[model samples]
Target: MASQRGRLTMGLVLILLAMTALAGRALQLQAIEAPAYASSAASKIQRAYTLHPDRGQIVDRNGTVLAASEPAVLIFADPLMISRNGIDERVSMGPLETQKAAAAPKAIAKILAKHLGGRPEDYRQMVTKTESDGSLARYALVRRHVPSYTYDLIKKDLAAGKWYGISATQDAVRSYPSGTVASNVIGFVNSEGQGGAGLEYALNKQLAGTEGKESYEASTYGRIPLGRATLAPAVNGTYYTLTLDATMQLTTQKALASAVASTGAESGEAIVMNVKTGEVLAMASMPTYDSSNLSAATSNEMVNHAIQDSYEPGSVQKVLTMAALTDQGLVTPDSRVDVPASISSGGGTIKDAFSHGSLALTARGVIAYSSNIGTTLLTRKMDKATFIKYLKSFGLGATTGIGLPGEAKGSVPTASMPDFTRDQISFGQGLSVTAIQEAAAVAGIVNGGVYHSPTIIKSARNGQGEAVKVPVSTSRRVISAKASAEVRNMMEAVVTLEPSRAVAGYRTIGKTGTAQRIDPSCHCYRGYTASYVGIGPAENPSILTYVVLNNPVKGHEGSGVALPVAQQILSVALPRYGVEPSTSKPPKAVLEYQP
Candidate 1:
């Protein structure tokens, strides 16, 4: 009897112990782990979505839109939501309701195809796609970059069914508003809305704003109504204003295309600048592609030739050589120099393009006639080292830092070289330069010897649409005001020679250049590069323009091929840009050698 009582007491204790343990577990679940459990449960029902910011607008100085981003949507779907929202009933009813429910995917696809422009079968496959666990896909991509108006219709139709799965996420689409105008300068963005080339690539940071985020309570298939909603608003990108003028850019491009067609040249580049501020008004390169249709363009057509490629600048080098000499008090425009038809140096013969006998000419006349021998002899006044120093100061051996893509750091002879190197360098050989560098160099003479790094980005607008900053450009004096003024007078002599002038009543000061393009295969002269760089209304000059033609098949000389094109641009551009005509008469020019 006592043993049986002990057994009963043990059973009671065991039962009491099990009950106490159950109570402790319930207390722990309701209190100690309650927050963690609630969080886990909420996470399954809550959706977090990323909000893409709108890319900034790119505009010209006149506020004309060049590139911009438009509001777009990313189409997505909730297959489970479509299945749960009685989509089966909408398709059909009757004894075959189960079979009808199975056909919901096909029926839904047909409706989607009506508005989305896709095959019904294709969308049906998407709607019925299963996950690894055999459940319908909760989320699926339908389309991206759908315009807002289109998504609105889809959203309205889906709303009637209590979130029937068709939905959209936020995105953006890049648009080039100006089409092919300044296309090379204002590059294109890829389908992913990323900048690819030109200023678009260079200044993408200011153009691509930061993304935001959103969190909301959601059902198994879509966002829950009247549920929690929290959002971190997106920060829109900053705006950029360029220095380019749309009118000038369009005009220059036309002139370049006409010049190339007429000259039978492979390609051409032209640049127009505000000399005082180094602002690029118009920069055009031929064989260009439309920014809106980038995929159709060849890589060659995408280059910004004015700033990207460097070529032997030929006689245009004399402009700087003369500038350096005059700055050093080595010669004046009227100082007399001896020039021969040809002179031998560095185991090679240097001569004028046209044969001439020995003659004494003023320094100004040497430039007007473009006598290679005269320039070589003139360089004897200064050593090779001094000449190189002047070239570096002209921004030849380094980048112009024009704040553009693919800017070439052109080649200049280093410390060690032969004596002929000096003669060659003096006349624009043994080196290379971009059209921008040459134009800016010429502008130095017009702007009283101060070389301003060429500028394209006028200002960066903040999110508030106020100008906060600008791209970096350096400006410093390289020659005295007097020296630059004299050089301008000398350049004027070149433009005003004999039966024709570069332009009438403009008092244009400029230089013509013709260089042999070395064949890449054998390093022998195979073609010619004709070019011209000039500034107009010589006194109080405001505009500096440069033109270069590669592989001219018709006229090869700088005078015949390049000068006329430069004249064409300046004649029309100067008058329209409001540059006043020169009131002073043309200077008495010693265009021919004396004695």
Candidate 2:
């Protein structure tokens, strides 16, 4: 009897202990860990947050907004909401509960079908299929990249519960006000709002502002109170005011296109820079791409030719060589030189366009005639070292430090140069340079011998209209005033004396060159690169224009083809800049030559 009682007591005690442990577990689950699990369950029920970014804007110099951003709506769905409403189970039943399951789907279909521009049956199929699988797909996108009108309609439908599981949050998108004007320079962004090319690529970091964060508490339905929110707004991108003038850019583009088409040439490029300040008033290339539709054009056509392509600058380089020689006082406008029909150098014979055999030529006459022999004789007066030094000083074989991307620093032959190579280089051979380099060098010659580093960005400005002056390098006197005057005078005579090739009523000064194009296969001269460089108002030069035509078909010459283009551009650009005709006559010191 005693043992039975003891066993019974122990059994009762064990049962009580087991019941107590079970009760404790129930309390812990319902009280202590309940909030965390409930919050997790709520999170799974609906989206807790939406990310929005402030889209960037691109503006012009005159505060005309080229590109802007506007608020937009983003659409999404909530799977948990549909599941809680038993829409999932009903939809999953297929043909059996198809009627009930499809009721909600049909409602969603009818509401969203118009927005998506899809058939009601299609929307039903898409919504039912997604709901059945307990999945939330942004089915049918019910309007992506939505505008304001569409957003209003969708919002009203959501408020009426006509479309379950649908939601929209605020977002921003890019807008271009000027349309395709200056498109190539302003550039565009990808869908993710990242800049790709042109000023966009050049100033990406500044344009792409710092992104911010949003942290907030939400209800089980993942819908926040209409007003209650903890939010951090994104910092908007900085505005860029370009140096490009929309009207001037358009005019230049039109001219370039006309010239390229009329010449029957492959392509062409042109730039109009301010002589006093290196502000690029107009820069353009033919076969340009629309920044809005850049992908539509080929890569070759999209490149900025003014800064990228390098060719034998031909007689354009003569400006530099003459500037160098005259600066050193080794040759003056009247300095006499013996013209040879052809001179042998580097296993090749350099010949003039039209040979002047054993004739007496003045320093200015050598330039006027573009005599390979006369210029060579003059360069022989200066050793190779001095010549190379002057070339460097003129920014040859180097970058122009123009802020554009893909700029080419052209080459000057530095290896295995024989004594004869000096003569070839003196007349703008055995060297290659970019159009910008040539333009900047010529600008130096005409702009009082000061070579100001070329610039495209006018000034870096802040939001307050206060600009931090981006200091341009001080213009250095690369040549004396007298030398500049002499070369300037000679160039003027080339245009005036050759009136048939000159623009009437314009005092233009320039040189024409036709350099033999090197044969890729044998490294011999097989074709020609034609170029003409000119400066206007020869007495007091204002604009320096360089036009180069490469490998022209049907035997083209610089004087015949390229000079005409230079004249056309000057006639139009000079009058546009309001530069008056020079009353001063061509300097009598110009040594006349018959080329």
Candidate 3:
């Protein structure tokens, strides 16, 4: 009996000890580990990190701000939070709470209508519509971009602090100050901050800054403490300072616009370059777009015609021929040739604009009169190999190396051509080139026979006004200094001699070209490509301008239409650049007749 009672007491003690251990474990879980586990659960419900991006700014060479970033707001909604009361079976609302449920849709509609000032019917319709998932009795907006003013109104009138559904977030947006001026070059951005065209597309990586990350802990009530977050501040993007002078760009654009409008031409392009440096001072193309509103213009209007389009350069190619002849020591300003009415070559005959009866003409006279027959005769004196070499050296049959996108290389005959092909190319036919290539060629002629690669960007800058110079290649002397001068002098005579191509008292040198357009149907001439290229201050020659009119209706000759426009642009542009007018006598015509 004693052994039995001892065993029973020990078993009772073991049971009490086991119960105590169980009770202690329950207290420990409720008191010590609960808060930690709750925190871990909360972390899963809320995302820990958010990214912030630094916006870029754009300024002109003069430091005028063209584009910058402005703070904005985004609005969102949670339908689950708003509709929970209507479908809950475990909890029942009292009379007042039940009354709130019936009126919730109307109340939300009223608030949205009052703040956003839209039709109440639209809001009511949005709230009452059934979602694909029948579980969601209320509507939830996936995302919405709202302006700052509308956000302010929502915060003031809706009392969103007490409501559980509405959410407001902050963001950055791009803003332009100069409106449509230089819009084509400045370009624009999409909502995601991606650049679309022009400088925006060219320097996107530099302009787009690194994104930063943010993390925070939120309470069950969705309130976040200020000190409990980890943040890495974003680094701002670098600023771009272009070489474009806003004033000069505007002036050029206006002139081109006027020319396009008055002449009723389909499109127009104008560019101004500093003769000393290859810095493009001003570049403008008509049918431009507003960077702020890209959709406002058609795709055709957005093209940068000066760099993208190429056509037969017509008489402008004569500048290259003049350079080739003089540089090879085969000709001089006074070198004379017997210019005939026309000459037969290979399988075709080359003709002049007008018949010349075996007239004796100097090398300079041929250029001044722009005779196809005379230029062809001059090319024959020089063999095909030497001609092709000089043409390539002048940057023909190749790209201008301008960094702009969609630039055409401009076509030139690759191999040794037949007599007809050589004759046509000598007179600026059977070849195609861009306006920029023509301008660069002219720069080679007047800028001491050196060719400098053209560029639109001037320099890049930061916020402190400190600048980094853009890399530029040194100018290469493509022809001798003496040859360049001889060509320059002859070109000057074209503008100054008899009935002067340009206006008097301007001291400008130029060449007129009228090339027949190739017709697709008959493979013969149907229209004309008229163009004029000129340089000012005939003695020093500071500015060079090239203008081309494609298929003009009334007068399709360069002298008739293109020369006057070139003269007007140079007249204003020269004085603007501080180039002094020349007081020297105009070039006198040199003439001789043959029977």
Best by TM-score: 1
Segments of candidate 1 deviating more than 4 angstroms: 1-25, 83-101, 104-138, 153-163, 220-226
lDDT of 2 by residue, 314-385 (tens): 766777888888888887777887777777776878788784567777777777777777787777777778
- The alpha-carbon deviation from the true structure for residue 507 of candidate 1, after best TM-score superposition, in angstroms, is 1.6
How much lDDT does candidate 1 score? 0.83
Name the candidate, 1 or 3, with the larger TM-score value: 1
Cα displacement (angstroms), candidate 2, residue 76, comes to: 4.1
Please list the residue runs of candidate 3 whose C-alpha ends up more than 4 Å from where it truly belongs after superposition.
1-39, 42-55, 65-67, 74-146, 160-170, 220-223, 462-469, 498-505, 519-525, 586-595
The digit string of per-residue lDDT tens for model 1 on 1-595 reads 9999999999999999999999899889999999999999787677777788888888999999999888889887667656654443235445555564555566667766767897888787676667889988767777778888888876665555334567677888888878778999999887776789988888787788788899999764346898889999887888988999988888889888898899888889999898888999899998788988877999878988888888898999899999999999998998888787788998889988888888798889889888888889998788778878888888887888888888998888865667898889889888888899888888976788988989998988766677767766689898899999989989888877743756666778889999988778998888899998878888887888899999889989888878877888888778877888888877788755546
TM-score of predicted model 1?
A: 0.91
Give the number of colliding residue pairs in candidate 1: 0
Local distance difference test values of all predictions, in order? 0.83, 0.69, 0.73
